[model samples]
Target: MMIVCAGLSAVVAGGAGAQHVAVSVQVSSDRQFVPLQSYVQGEVDGKLLFFCGLSDMGLHVFGQGAFPAKNFSRQIVMVDRATGAVTTGTTDHLPLATRQAMTVTAPTAVQYGSILYMYGGYGPDLENPGDYFTRALCTAIDLVQVKNALQASQPVPASAFTHTECVAGKVAGAGIVKLGDRFALICGADADGEYGSAPDPEYTNVVQIFDRNVSYVNPVETLDDGQGFFSPMHRRDVNVLPVRMPVDRAGFVVVCGAFESGIFLYENPLIWGEGDAVPYEDNEFIQHIGGYEGPIASLYSASHDRNHLLIFSGLSGYEYIDNEFVWNPAAPWTRQIVNLHVDGGVFARELVLGEMPWPLTNAKLVLENTLPKTTDGQVLVDQLPFGQPILLGRIYGGIAAEKQGSVSPTYASDAVLDVYVTVTPEGPVEVRPSAFSRVRGLHVSGGLSDLLQSDDLRLVTRPDVFRTSAVPPVQIQVVGTSPLQNPSEIKFTVESRASANNISQRVRLFNYDTQKWEQVDARTMPLSDTTIVVTISTDPARFIDDATGEMKALLQYNALAFTIAPIWQAGQDLTMWTIVP
Candidate 1:
């Protein structure tokens, strides 16, 4: 399948049938593989066979509920990027500890030259803590042997891998990136056990470079901790994508992740470089980009200097309320297929709405377009102006949540997507959201009716009309004084002219995950002239079970509003206001 997105001018000049750079996605009908096992994956010889991950085949999210020992999978899953084919086999033959080190939930992992190196992740305790009980264990997968065995159709032996047990430096969830030879692992903590609240001594915002030749990681510098505000220095669950400079040099762009040090936890994509202890420039490029944010995947187009980040669906952080920071660990997972133009080490985000699947967090994208014959083939970076539809890569095995909380039980996604990027002459494409129009009747309604009065729904208030007959409950859609990327509780209060018994109010909320409107239950105030307030929110408790990140976009796109009316009596009227506090 091919989807085209081109500039209007280019298309008009080229006439109909003109093509431009476009992207499309297709899920194979017959390829439903049970991917209960989740793992950090990398392309080996351009194939996805190098990995260390496990998913509980049962019905639970990673850190939630009891850890199921029986279904823990330690396997090398190879996904053919060209055809969207996934193949897996148990790597359980390796030492149990090595497998566990690689199987920890949301570990900082990367792959290089037939070796999958994983560091710092949350999991069961190991005796070899950096001498302490920790999940900061590190392990390496020797894909050279695994690949040979697979080519021969022979079972892999346990001796084919290497394990580096815990140390004070052994950390989980640290953000890491590789320049040439050195792997700079950044900000993470030493945890005692699984899903515990906090870490003992937070791993200082230090840069630990693990050179390929060195046996141990060497600490270089520590970053200044941010006090009164948020900083990326002391953060975990962060991801970095590769970028190329206009010159010969290239580096990684650190995407935003979850940070708990502040009163509120959220992500703001920041770019920094190893060349300088300072970042490219302190900037947060806001785009339509979506992701599970932390446990995410990225593909860089060296030719285009563009990084395609696959932000699968996952939880979001909190919004600052009156004085408190309200967080939603299970912010609905919305599908985000975004990219960034990297130049001079700076990032410019491009929020593109494309033909994509639901966001898959904790998922891995493997490039399969490289030469297939050689074991060490050249890496193929996606280039625009496909001239025709071309397969870009494949996404396999990640968790898709059905609930708001990451701790809640979630089933593994069973399908894999094949991304086809095409460049046509259609010109640069822009999509405008459809105009909203609707008005409510007597009972209850949602959609455009809840929005504020417009030219379509003109509000001509006749104060004199209340002198005789009855007044109707008013529904209003609100656009605020300022725009909000992450919003907290939005409140709607009605000052009723009648007795408290005559007050009634309702709201229509859009649930992106379910693609439905949820009704907010209304209630009356205690006073005679009641002031009834109902809050519309993204709080997991207030939203539908599986709603996702798209809700924020829907609300921001001039679609947030609610209704207020008199339910018990006919001769009553009310005044209303909306507040996002």
Candidate 2:
């Protein structure tokens, strides 16, 4: 599933309107602001750096972290957007007392002097019975000390330097950013103060700013909303990241949470406004901001320039799907309807700005008078299937919801969808396979497409692994269908799943070469009434090999309704598969 045949591993090429080629960097973890199970990134020197905090769950083994405190061990392991080089370092030896005062669950980090200041999280302690009771405040780790010792083997920077002390709490949400010439960190409930007699503090609007151009750094209190500052504030799952839009010449911060009602933002931090606040349970704000029209759904706030704010993909129930809506700036909560077209030929579970591994999902819309287009004068389309190819269908699992019956906790078991296509001798033979469901969009690309385009295609396939190491020849069997009159080119595709709001599966293609399975290039085609065979033996070779894995092509599918006895159902039933071995 990782090594797809669509775009090159290091290089990618779209249809015709492709501009500059983009390379994908494997991000180890999510963002730094959240108390992730793994890594986080802190911004320094105008660049994002990566770090890892203590994670027992082993979620992000190579994840990153940002600075949370001044007195803890901090190091700079990566430089933002650097693809050529790799850097690694460690922290200085901690005093016996300092070591005893830290815990892994309470690790902290903060950005200072272009370095991430990391500190203790949940750890064992000698001061209290069992494990608890250390003052949850972490000191900053100096960047200069860590960077200077990069080439050295035992490179733990010295802790003799005095570090700043703030909330030694576990970091969550997005890392703080500077506004104009000021430094600020936007955070919600502090976990350290949440337990025991202290019980931690709840959601509070806190903005700490520092003096300008000072040689020695000392942050000043800029604003505080006392608990109700921004009530219905972000919960644990949501994150607040500051953004300075070009329109108002002011700073604005966006708050995105899970299952939340809408997106929220602060126009000007210096001024205070008594605005109404909406509440949400498990929210996922915005993944990437592409364009905006107005208030998309319930997420809306005042705007200095335009009215809408568009968002791409985010977290939801058992599956993650793409969400597109425009929020009005004046009303902030109302949505202005507009089409935020999806980019095609790319897939992803998560994506970041600039050179991310996948195309931007749920991308927030950027207001522009002119729409984007492809290199060949075609308009850029994100989710819809195109071309003359026939759709082959897909495979997936069934729902586990109580209303769906059975009542098993493991709802999505072994369910599948299969598509079949037939083509005349010469009509159209090119096909693209695309799938959509509650899981977003996954287009079929790579060698499958090449097998469809070229001749001498050999395909070795395994249904279990859903991959082939060799190229697959196009296989077309003539049946009762009429042969194409003036056969030009034939295409095929399969729409086997529902939209991003429902259960969908992935469909891939490969070629058979010599005596093995070779992954091939393929695309998702639009569904149609009449079926067409887009695949023919592009290359001749031996039979498909099942030694490596299952040889049958299988598509994951989920049945929405039951199959009754006497009374017939409206929709198509029974799993479909091509048995041409």
Candidate 3:
């Protein structure tokens, strides 16, 4: 879901003595390589390796040689999580040609245990700067050895690269996810080279699958036929993100990404195994992230019941000026970090965590320590015997540009992003029960002390600005067990010193067919000099209209929202709703 609710922020009081479950970010000075993206990255034992990409943080001048040559006998950048140390290493034993192909940009890499397996990308032809060669090689780095070598201040161990295989046509830019023995290559493609216009490389409209057992067993340094795949997926790109659900194991979502070399935002997320892909108009979330022509990275939360995807620096918001798209070739990438929080079942919410100091995108989010998981891959919360924060790991470089439309020789990066996660005990769930009905998961603004203060109880509108076309209500959701949705009346008690007429209120039910809100009438009566009871009833003649199926769609909802804009402070609103059985 793009987003069910726009936002939800509260000044709630909790016994934990903290304000809100928040996200924090910090950055270290680069002092090494410049900003870089679309390169191969992997993490092991708290050490991160920034392998192969446009070596310089500027326009990739054609004849600048592969990263292996540039890094030859030189130390490769490595970030240590435990000590927050940024260092470099050298794989001096690898052959010159081998190193050159390995440093190719736009390659695909995935980390499992101590092994970092990488695939195809565009590398040097050794002749023209613009003309390039599509690399047809796969290399595996033994991360444990590299980490140990970095510790000893030694060149990358001779045994660092335990295996290398050559597999043609398995190009770069594919969204890869390892599922058991099979790894899927979600909609990504490659070309012969960006050699002129007519002979430009074509994209593949297929989701390719490769068997790990078959892929890794090839003779070291020998080329293989490498025939293992499942085809015919809609062409996708760097935007595909992994999300595991009970129904779909090892599932992934392809958000806003380029297809057919064109910038278009799909409406709904494209699932890995969904028959055919169809997206809607998404202007808020993914559409805002430029053409997605740049790099993007994602990491999921390990806390149970918390599903959040952190997307860092992928060219934010395609500029639209006066109803026209303002396309700029030199637009710099974003420094903003967006957090997508999934709550209330399929309902999802969006929040902006914070921003990085500089433009950063297309990087790595490596897990430093082991995360508890069930046999089914669900987050293993009960498995934990104690309560403590998990120091999951850190984020590494992407492309960091100096300015918009920056010239070449300055377009990459060498920096570290520090991250930490804290979790608390689950609090008691609040349930609203009345003589007629019961509502579960009703999150109110107050704690025990605030709820006890009668003076703080009143009816007022929500403080935050809710989107104009939202249905049901922002915080009030109704899950009625009974099929009788057409309640004869809904009663709510409120306290107000002003005239009852001055307390303007409207009740809107979600219309299923029109996808809009329809307002209904409510009658009011005085409860006391400063209190009142408002009753809203359904038209029985409307139920008769429900028989025609036309009005049935509109009257078939179990819950409705009441937007009450009282003169009093809305943050103090005290609301208790009841349905006439």
Residues 1-581, candidate 2: write the lDDT tens digits: 22223321111122332221111223233222211222334443323333433322211111112222221223334332222134555432555454443323333344545555444343334345233332334445454454445535455445523444545233333223444455444443443322333443344344444433541134555354444534434333332323223333333333343212323332111211112121221122333332211111111112111111122222222111235323323212111122111122111112221222221111111111132322111222221112112222211111112221112122221212221122111112222222111111122222333323223322122122222213211221111111222122222233222221222222333322443333333333222221223343433112223222112232332212332222211111111112121
lDDT of each: 0.45, 0.28, 0.44
What is residue 288's positional error in candidate 3, in angstroms?
2.1
| Residue 556 C-alpha lDDT in model 1 | 11
**Candidate 1, residue 230: CA error in Å?**
5.4
Q: Give the winner by TM-score: 1 or 2.
A: 1
The candidates, ranked best first by lDDT, are: 1, 3, 2
lDDT of 1 at 326: 47
Q: Global CA lDDT of candidate 2, please?
A: 0.28
Two-way TM-score contest, 1 vs 3, winner? 1
Rank list by TM-score: 1, 3, 2
Task: Write down the RMSD of candidate 3 (Cα, Å).
Answer: 17.0
TM for every model, in the order presented, reads: 0.57, 0.36, 0.55
> What lDDT does candidate 1 reach at residue 11?
8
Clashes of each: 35, 171, 24
How much is the lDDT of residue 260 in candidate 3? 26
